[model samples]
Target: MADPTDLNLPEEREHVYKQQNDDVPASSLNSTPSSSWWSSLLAASGLVSPLDFAFVLFSVVYIFFLGKFAFPPQSDDPSKDPPVFKAEGIMVKTGPAFGAVLGLALPIAYIFHGVLEGDQEGIEAAVPHVFLLASQAFMDGVAYSDRFSTPIRVFMPVFFSAKKIFTLMDWVGNEFSKVCVGGGCDAAAERRVLLGRGLAVANLVFWSLDLFC
Candidate 1:
């Protein structure tokens, strides 16, 4: 019988004494992870990426804005109860609420389908993102409404100088587009993901000083 050690190449024999711990999996070495983004981001910056934080922030903010904020009650004494909300504000909120539901619902349905097909890698990430964008859209709609803004002047005269809500509308719309596009296992998925992240960075840049409506 031939000795196995005798079959080793000269280079392999010389390096055989060293530890051979290079047991990386081919899948990891060859392709990017479906959502290694969070850890990779933390590794690179020693903090959560602004976009990831923004995604959660917008979700929490808009959820509170839409589902929880209490408007000041109307009163006979104008000074005592400044008009900060209007009847139309309630009606105006519907559009964004509907948009938010639809935005969140669409991706959730997609995730459900993926689960049925046994692709569980992305279902968790996609669900909250769509919800966040939807919330942002809702905030945009409410804040931009004159019905909501008209009354704020009495409470905080300098709250909105002019046309600022419209700016929020535009920024949220831009973000909504990114979240809308950032899904699926299509060929352009990587690009869509990057653009969706840009939405978060944009939020930090443009929507950081957001005013409550």
Candidate 2:
């Protein structure tokens, strides 16, 4: 017979190898291939890439055209209407949490904005009427009128005024720097930034003026 010691050594080595093979199954051997397959599917579906610059450009043009075509009746004086206008109800469907926050907050923004527009130094005691009317219109637009409680709309404008004031500070700072550096700057940058500042200031002024008006 073969040497007994050599025969036993082969058997021990074979047992160790078998245990290792059992621990690592054949299905786990090609994990990379499966991952690559999923990645390929995503790429083929065009879902993995960011929106191209061309697509963004097209979308902006499309919205501009749509706005011009669809909202003509709403604009007897589009020239005076706010450039940043948005119907509050349209935003309600964006998400429940956001809708709730905005729904709660917008009436306040309107109130503060209305009071300030009237030239009040702060919220006048009588601004709630206009705030309620505006809030009702906004809720009517969104089809979510049931969500508006009377107290929420009554106090909403103060919150909105605070928010607007916060955003206005950035506009003020930027415009002030541009004006400070004045030296016959070209029409495009100067005109655009100047116009932007004017609009910002005008918006705040109008809102504030409404308090007295």
> What TM-score, computed on C-alpha atoms, does each candidate reach?
0.26, 0.30
The digit string of per-residue lDDT tens for model 1 on 88-170 reads 44333343234323333344454556467554434434534433343333233333222232233232212221223443344
lDDT of 1 at 132: 37
lDDT of each: 0.34, 0.32
Candidate 2 accuracy as TM-score:
0.30
Model 1 RMSD in Å is 24.9
Q: After superposition, how far is residue 33 of candidate 2 from its true place, in Å?
A: 44
Q: Residue 65 of model 2: what lDDT?
A: 51
What's every prediction's RMSD, in angstroms? 24.9, 30.5
Q: Give the alpha carbon lDDT tens digit for every residue of 1-213 in model 2.
A: 121111111011122232346565322321223223322332344322243223323433543454446333243422222322122433222322232223223323433453445423122221222222222222222211122222222223332344344334544554555552365656654554455455446544544432222
User: In candidate 1, how many Å is residue 23 off?
Assistant: 66
